[model samples]
Target: MKKYRITVNGKTYEVEVEEITAPAPAPKKETPSVSTIEAPKAKAEPAPTPAATPKKATPAGKLTINAPMPGTILSIKAKPGSAVKKGQVIMILEAMKMENEILAPQDGKILSIEVTEGSSVNTGDILAVME
Candidate 1:
């Protein structure tokens, strides 16, 4: 056996380590006859619980345009008072180091611009409005 003392942060402690020997191996038991044992029957699994129905997301209004995901506004392609068609690119959002185009969802004149260039927005945040 060996003993040692250690000090840490003004506290001292003594530790002793004894030499270890390998343990003797255990003896193996004889296997039982397979015919003497009956096979176990499978248990039936419980039925899965039903999930809750999700509520529909109702937009505040048809004219409100919201961000689809969290990101920074890279550029605004159209400004207020500008006429736009459905599927037209309205702005660029930088998210996850990639540029994503924000599109005009319907044909209308932009009523207001809610976010400025280089501004950060989260999912469902209003970015623009049209009517």
Candidate 2:
């Protein structure tokens, strides 16, 4: 037999263990019955369909740009009506002590500028619109 002390979360406990020399008892076995009843079958159900998302309708000729992460708008390089190419950097964002370039998603003119220099923004916050 052995004894030990244990502490957990500011709580203390004492434990003891003893060696066994006797053999373990044999497990019991059951006989199968000759006459068994079967369970009733359940009806199959149809799978549920996912609900359609309601789209945010941007003005017909315009599009909305959202922030990719939480950050401060460091600078704006595009103004309203400024022509931009797909993947062109329109703004600089500072997030997590790193600078990130917010780019135009498609070749289009800047329809509107929603954020200004030094403005803090969260993920998915609209930054600008291009069309």
Counting clashing residue pairs in each candidate, in order, gives 0, 0
TM-score of each: 0.54, 0.55
All candidates' lDDT scores? 0.88, 0.89
CA displacement after TM-score superposition, residue 99 of candidate 2 (Å): 0.5
- CA shift at 58, candidate 1, in angstroms? 12
lDDT of 2 by residue, 1-131 (tens): 89989999999999998989899998769776798789899788887886653445578878899999999999999999999999999999999999999999999999888899999988878889888
- Report the number of the highest-lDDT candidate: 2
Over the stretch 42-74, how does candidate 1's per-residue lDDT look in tens digits? 899998986643423434654888899999999
The TM-score, computed over Cα atoms with residue i paired to residue i, of candidate 2 is 0.55
At residue 93, candidate 2 shows an lDDT of 96
Please, what's the RMSD in Å of model 2?
16.0
